[model samples]
Target: MHDSRAVPFVCPIDHGVLEAHGDWLVCVQCAQRYPVVGGKPVLLNEANSVFRIADYTGGNAYGGASAYGTAGDGSRGLKRLYHRIVYTLSESGAGPAAPFSASDAVAAVQAADPDAQILIIGAGETSYAGNITYTDVAFGKNVRCIADAHDLPFADGSFDLVVACAVLEHVADPARCVAEMWRVLKSDGRAYAETPFLQPVHMREYDFTRFTFLGHRRLFRFFDQIEAGISSGPGMSIAFVLRTTLANSTEHRALGAVLHLAGLVLSYPLRLLDHIFTRSNGAYDSASAHYFFGQKRETAIPDRDILQFYRGA
Candidate 1:
């Protein structure tokens, strides 16, 4: 980065400080080099960098690029416009979801430094569909670094804010990913994460874990709770289940697509129920996805406290 305030990154492989060595980020200790492509540091460990980059840069980036979409601007504009309305209700459920709607995460970060260094985990191109690409409004223009969420390459307490939307489930170790995010944040820093609770598996097999509303709270128990609640309502969850059931019942990919499309159309109206259902007492039990936002602290979350956070399905 040209600015002196740029967040200097460490080497994820060895956790060693790295310096700009031509077009590479060279670790001062191991002398290993991580390539910088298109101004973004490829901070992933060697094991992931090789395979993941192929998909991240190529047109089919399901390997690990959740936020980063595949190439081509083909229908992105139309997709964004459509989802802007449809997705808001389906995922949000009820009145308003916390953390995901969370300007608080940004507020907490901005409180420390107006030009705070915020890091977005799994920041990459939009998905293969381009519908989920990064919005400049949410992630401000100051975000200058891009790296793997699981293995962040930054000195301890370097960032003011970290946001991971729909990313934890993709990583093999969500705990490790959270810990890494914590490690990079300043004590006053905050983090926001979102994950599905009842939604079907997505992003191929890369999709892994789903958490209860309370389970989501416990995920970031290490931090002081700013807010956490349903990001996507239960209506969307039921819709996905319907789509999944129909898709699995048939072997024909084309027919499966038709069924899923039809399911979504029928289900689209169901989300209106979320305005009531998401606010119901059983909302957490049937939530489509959840969001958690909190601030970092010095004390560790107690194991005993964690055990008691479940609200159940």
Candidate 2:
């Protein structure tokens, strides 16, 4: 269980300091009560967010539900099979080697400050250190808090490192969410994110956006680039397109599953092409995904200057 007091949590609405009151956290400014479910605080601004605090407190929120399937025991076997197919399809072709190590970033931050506050937004079964706080939109086994990325429920400049890996695409407003991330980070703090570019939609309704290498850099213009490049290559993009196409070809669930598996098998060889594609500068035009690791800066990069930094062929 996380010690809430250790975290610099604030009311999402007014950004006010909160006081614990029985089973709730009351905002000192607005006096609005937010529920503490189990041990994690469901800190959502009900008016601004699509999710309601009541959804979590009432145990109605569905954590990690994808558009592909429902969360039920009866579909567990099918879901397992579907996941296996995806894993096999994505294993080899997903991308090229990453330019930087995420773990190394965590270690460097910890080395700088042993008691550093690290926040992982949309952290799904990813835990880096004891000092890190894991937050998601819904309750999960590893989630320390339920938070909306667009309006993070934490004090400004409260964290040393903020990670939003593979999360921005799912949010309705990536820019606003990124701004919230910038807002919560201390001066010269670090931000790391991985967002899809050429990938097919998997999370269904939850997936909202995609960004190219240049677009990804533009998104984090507020951060001085430390290192940014393709995390997944063109091979993975081909595999994803094939699989999604076959899977959605028909309304028949059983047949669609079989076709999806077949797509994976058919595209297996094409996925291996990433080995060559990732080495070419031209691959940036069709790269599957991009990653950005940067530090917070007071000045945003000008649009014209950002265009000059484009590496695509």
Candidate 3:
């Protein structure tokens, strides 16, 4: 269980301090609940039916986790280089900032101004915390981490910047999620969001959809300035295709365990190839993810639209 005093964030659905309950976290507010097995929150009930939670819990992540084949030492190497090469390639495609190191982008903003108030949406355990690792030691204490994403608990225009990573894909309505982010952001604030484009079925506890680069651009149209691009090289696509093919085999259920083990071994060599072939900038034909940064333009408030207002005014 997390030490509440240390984290202090409440659940978005229930607004209660998340308390550990039988391998899950139960909220006292709405009583809406989720699991925390393996130290990762199981945010969606739907995941229980579609995924093998037991397999995930047993350290058989190669079979049960997202990107089923990228768990072993060998596969991990390949996956890392795959992301590195792809991200490097994406930097050359478009935008002010380079595509490499979201950690750097995040750190750059935090370091530029000491008083910059920031918001982290879908404040999951890993990605958010991981970003903080690269943050300058000077600004670490000033940041706030909120656990809720669906309905941000803060007042509107409360922050100078907002960051969301790999989050919209898990929400029921990506459009609504984008709207909420826009709502909380100060008129002058900028927001950064990143998500996968073509990847495996892992992170499916609440996984809803993936975006094409163009689709991401459409989603962020509200912003005055938006830059959308992809991440990871072609090797990731190769890995996805191979595993997906195996997963659909007629005898999959029977041979899944063996195949998963085999995948771990294969992932290493594939990762090496990724480094060789994907080291330079090229068109994102094989980009596995997408990211965008947008600056809010001062505009009329959206929620107070004509539909809800009196026509006589």
lDDT of 1 by residue, 100-209 (tens): 45355665555555677767665543222111112111121223344556677778897777778778777777888898889988888788888888888876776779
Best-fitting candidate, measured by lDDT?
2
Model 2 segments more than 4 A misplaced: 1-5, 65-95
Best by TM-score: 2
Residue 257 CA error for candidate 3 (Å)?
Answer: 2.6
Q: Which pairs of residues collide in model 3? A: 66-202, 78-271, 86-232, 86-233
Please list the residue runs of candidate 1 whose C-alpha ends up more than 4 Å from where it truly belongs after superposition. Answer: 1-4, 47-104, 124-146, 307-313
* Candidate models: Cα lDDT each: 0.65, 0.82, 0.51
Per residue, candidate 3 scores C-alpha lDDT tens digits across 132-229 of: 31111011122242123455434466565677777777666777667767876678777788877777665446578876655665566566544545
Residue 199: error of model 1 in Å?
1.3
RMSD of 3: 10.9
Better of 1 and 3 by lDDT: 1
Candidate 3 TM-score, C-alpha based: 0.56
Q: Name the 10 consecutive residues with the lowest summed lDDT in model 2.
A: 65-74
